[model samples]
Target chain A: MPEPLLARSALRAHVAPEIAAPAPGVVLRERTDLTLASVAAFKGREAELADAVRSAYGIELPTTPTRVAAGEVAFVWAGPGKWLATATGPVDFSTLPAAVADQSDGRSVLSVSGERARETLATLIAIDLHPRAFTSGDAALTHAASISVHLWQTDDAPTYEIAVFRSYAATLWRWLVHAGQSRGIDAKL
Target chain B: MRIACPHCGLRGVDEFAYFGDASVTRPAADAAETAFADYVYLRDNPAGAHRELWSHALGCQSWLVVTRDTRSHAIETVEAARDVALARTSEAQS
Candidate 1:
């Protein structure tokens, strides 16, 4: 069999060196909910959420420089004026960007591909994904079943990323599992 | 939508992107802060045809003016930055 085009370990490194490969057949769970987000600060004006988080804490989050291909990186927009770049690590969520990084808060990063990804997401998402409205790199930040999840088409893989508040990750995961089971597919990760 | 981005050639909706209304008039030189804020932030989402500014940020990265229906998402016009300025006044009057 041809080797897997992408090594999850390599991909993980591309996001963060601290995020090593998943254990053999064991996906990383400590940071079970994986998503990429960022905050692009322009002259330190516009919006801020990370700065506030940092003022309260003393750690800085990882941030990828803009203009690089998102293909080589996993990132997401965390807010209207910011983004959040993520990977596995005991990240200091309180860290904030200094300049433009300091201005914007972030946007969203959504997981949209998985064995039964579409089927699982269909329960909450409303955008028409039938080849017409969705293709690779197609993203939308709208309500899926009244819940806001930034949707993005991951590199044509079966695992997609979705971003939601920390409070709803479990509920969203449960919904995905239920939907996946209905399709005779088990979405364990 | 796959726009023929002036800079990046042709890219998917993910490569290029959208901005808000393009025809809204800018605030005058001594406009109040609130008025200026409204001009900069508020979008005129008319139900019918509208001129909107879009960018191929992930593509060629040039500014584009696209005429699309606010309700139906039908595009009636697509032009580069230079031409979009020409239609600005006519759009504001409509």
Candidate 2:
């Protein structure tokens, strides 16, 4: 039999011991245990797709630039009629009435939390990230440091998740490190 | 400058890419060569309010038709390109 495949982090080469240590100001963690898929409803069939998704995942599909989470599954609006669906476990979208493309290995997700999370992100992204402006469950399909990124606030602890194309993961990590340099980053690879 | 994306709310202009006049429509395939050339190469430089095509490249990735005052740099309205096209189709049908 052939050798089993190995899963490796996109930031494996960039993970330095000093950066990985638990710092006090900001906590950054890479999320690799997610099954991601891009879902796009066919023209005039958005309602049908939403209904199918609701029945399958028990969560409403966000029609705007927002995120709706039910248990471990979350649907983030990427554009008009388009959404990025993520789950901790495998989600079968085969029967859904929409175009679905698996993105599990195509994207990288990083979670930023703690007191300086918002400030650090504010320096990189152009959107208004204030607590009142961007509360929990709010998501945006914006860019960070010129890299297209999808950002969402998961909780009031102010934990934010930023997802970027896998190829840009290292660049995003560098930007995060630079942004959090003075503030102290607790990066967990 | 900022564009209030219909679906994404207000966003910086840098997040969007200009695609020129939204008023331009494709001519029929069997139309005259002169008409095809005009459609492909001609654009009117208007000083007043104009409808332009812009794509939100980094945010939401929606094509928008923005009606803006060229002289004042003020945006009067923004609509999704899909909706605008659909409306045009319905108008033509009706």
Candidate 3:
């Protein structure tokens, strides 16, 4: 008989669900319930794959480095031939024509919200996070805290969802926590 | 240096992984030893505009061909490397 299995979040050992009002303007929280998957179009099958995704999920798999949402599922273009999809609950892509792989356990997600969130992100990412530049629903794969991470502007309050490999999550979280110290942080870990 | 990625806009150099000289062409498999050696070991250290392959490792993950002035670090143009290479192949065949 197979041994019993247990599942744990990437931040299980790093963060706990609690709010720390470190300063007056920022709130950091672990995005614990995200479900992620990497979807890539098979070679020479781009259009067909996209049609299948749209028909199945009711949203276009973005072609450029942008983000789009329909209901609970959010899609971010990962690159030319690929996209990453995220939802608050389990998302099954088995019916789509694209190659889909589970990334829910492969990444750690964090959300930094509040009025000062953009300013805080600027200290780590070089991209123009200004609302004029990276407005709501915008996403990009970028370097932050010296690690490759995906960042998305989820709301007008300038909330951001940062997704990084599980291995780099701890280091990135530490950097973010430190960066927010000056402005004070409302951490909901 | 900052590169204006076609898809993701201007981004820091740290987000990219550079591989020098996109202009380099691999010698044919049956080419002479000298030709293969040159392909493997030789590269031009151009003083002016140079084209190189840069993979946006952190964002978009698109491989781009960036043409920039080395002396001033001014980027001239950026395009998808796959598109450029495919165009080149078709151009050569034509």
Candidate 4:
């Protein structure tokens, strides 16, 4: 039998000791526990796909750029008739009527929170992150430093989760660290 | 410049890629040579109120048809290309 492969973090080499220690203003952590999948509805079968997602995940499929959560499962609208489904535990995507592709290893999620989290993110994201404009549960598929990213707000603490392609994770980490430098960052992976 | 993406809301123009004129349509397989030449080589560089194609490369990744005034750089309207194509297909069928 072949040897089992071990999973390694995308930021393993880039996350230095100086960046990992706890800081006061901004807290950054890599979320490695969640399982991710890209779900795309078939043309002309959007309603069927939505129904299947609702029954299987106990959450409504978001038609707009928003995030909807039910229990441990959360769905963030990626594009028209497309969503990025994330769950902390195992999820059966087979029953869904749409096309589902595993993205657990294809992407990396980084969570940023704290008193100056919004300020730190402001330097990188071009869109408005103000509470009134982008409140909790809002999601956006935009770019940061010209690299494509899927960003979403989770709670009132103003915690934001950014998902980027696996290869760009290190570059994103560097950008986040630089952006949060003035505010101070507590980076942990 | 900013574009109001139908799916992702307003975003910077840098997030999108200009795909040129949206008025051009593919000719039939058995179309005349002149028709094919016009479709491939001929393009009208209108000075005002031009319909163009743009893809939201960084956001949502949706292709959009934007009607803009070339002289003033004012975007009159933006619609998803899929909807526009679907409408054309239905119109042709009808």
Write one digit per residue (lDDT tens) for candidate 2, span A72-136. 88899888899989999877765779999988888999999988899989999999999778989
| Model 2 stretches with alpha carbons more than 4 Å out | A1-3, A17-23
TM-score of chain B of each: 0.68, 0.97, 0.94, 0.97
Q: After superposition, how far is residue A155 of candidate 1 from its true place, in Å?
A: 6.4
Q: Model 3 clash pairs?
A: A16-A189, A17-A189, A22-A184, A22-A185, A23-A184, A23-A185, A141-B58, A141-B59
Question: Using DockQ as the measure, which candidate wins?
Answer: 4
Task: Indicate the residue-level lDDT of B14 in model 3.
Answer: 82
TM-score, every prediction: 0.42, 0.95, 0.93, 0.97
TM-score of chain A of each: 0.51, 0.93, 0.92, 0.95
Residue A87, model 1, lDDT: 43
In terms of TM-score, how similar is model 4 to the real structure? Answer: 0.97
Question: Which portions of model 4 miss their true places by more than 4 Å?
Answer: A19-23
The best candidate in terms of lDDT? 4
| DockQ agreement of candidate 1 with the native complex | 0.04
Strongest candidate by TM-score = 4
lDDT values, one for every candidate: 0.49, 0.89, 0.84, 0.90
**Pairs that collide, model 2:** none
Candidate 3 chain A has its poorest 10 consecutive residues by lDDT at A15-24
Q: Report lDDT (Cα) of residue A70, candidate 2.
A: 93
Interface RMSD of 4: 0.5
Clash tally for model 3? 8
Misplaced by over 4 Å in model 1 are: A1-37, A43-73, A77-82, A91-114, A126-142, A152-157, A185-189, B1-49, B52-66, B69-73, B77-94
